[model samples]
Target: MSTVTTATNATTTHRSARSVARRTAWLAGALFWSAFAVLEAVNHGWLAGTLALTFFVLPDLTFLVALDDAPRMAKGQLPPCAVPYYNALHRALVPLALLVAYTVQPFFAWAPLFAALCGWMAHISYDRAFGYGLRTKEGFQRG
Candidate 1:
């Protein structure tokens, strides 16, 4: 094979490996965090459990913000108006940051906040493991 062909093959191989690693990492995260959230609920109270469950389903509710536009869009695409909300909610950093904040300040009641963050992280992790991720400005999954 030509040098260019060899380079292309190497790049593709690298990307494929990275993709597998990424998916595996997220899957592990989903399992751990989801379990952590459940444990927190069992240990703490209904408040902890309820908040965790609520936040897990909350991110996807952004779709309701642009329901009318959803029909015209391609499958797996968020409407442009809802893209910002979807992207923000889907990002792991947001919940991670909140968890850090809770650690630093201890301002909120601990158990519920912790459980909610864990659940949110679990949701994001599951989405990533399944190949969903933050949307592009055009509302399509980023390449």
Candidate 2:
């Protein structure tokens, strides 16, 4: 009976921890996108600004679709072992990709791509500012 109680407590604690992780991740993501959209809308047209914001969130949305536990992780339900995937999507690869694209086609300015990159940077900045960091196999922790 004592062992059973101990196991139950441990499980509850683990679930709580995962929940915190997911909520924080979602908060950070939301903050980034919101701030980015507002900033872009001030400088660009509303439609373009929102479209850029969508592009910024596209990678994360893709992960949510591809990973079984991604939504759960975002909701703080279960610990996710998706650190690598998260890192890949959150990194500066989008900007770099845009740079490469521009280099390949010097005539095309690719303003929209640049806007998306800005949105991506905004998201990463928000995550760092909010202490969401990244997830690990065990759980989310500050990096």
Candidate 3:
């Protein structure tokens, strides 16, 4: 299900309930990712195991932040945030994919891996489906 609610601020006004809904949707996406960490801990090992999972996530953070400027610098907001979103999903899905390739002992290690990939894919698809993408034109007009 989806919703469309509008809010106006003294400093700014958002157009369409879609903007707020988009933001709310992204928040939920992040929350879902964080929640995956918790579930991963239980399935993969526990608190310590999840901490070990951090080893996988940390490099991803570095790469994502490091590349944050590259796309903007190159595209000048041309390709827009589709680059970051795609990269973020790749950053997330890659390790999870590796986990799938390397996991042993229990079969469920792949579950969180699968969930993370699904979440990433779903968010990207949602954004694309809803026409929610970074602005590409100069002085991008307000919604």
lDDT, candidates in the order shown: 0.93, 0.62, 0.47
Q: Global lDDT for candidate 3?
A: 0.47
Candidates 1 and 3 compared by lDDT, better number: 1
- Counting clashing residue pairs in each candidate, in order, gives 0, 1, 0
- Taking the tens digit of each residue's C-alpha lDDT, what string does model 2 give over 32-143? 6556556656666766576677766765553453466655555542244555667666665555576467668867564555556667766665665565555555545644
Please provide, for model 3 over 24-73, each residue's C-alpha lDDT reduced to its tens digit, 9 standing for 90 to 100: 77657656655655565567555434453544344324234435555445
What candidate 3 gets wrong by more than 4 Å, as runs, is 1-14, 46-109, 115-143
Per-residue lDDT tens digits for candidate 1, residues 51-115, read 99999999989999999998899987889999999988999988998988888885765888899
Clashes of 3: 0
Question: Is candidate 2 or 3 superior in TM-score?
Answer: 2
Measured by lDDT, the strongest candidate is 1
The C-alpha stretches of model 2 lying farther than 4 A from their native spots are: 1-47, 59-63, 66-82, 93-108, 137-139
For candidate 3, the per-residue lDDT at 37 reads 52
Best by TM-score: 1
lDDT of 2 at 126: 60
Candidate 2, position 66, lDDT: 41
Candidate 1, poorest ten consecutive residues by summed lDDT: 100-109
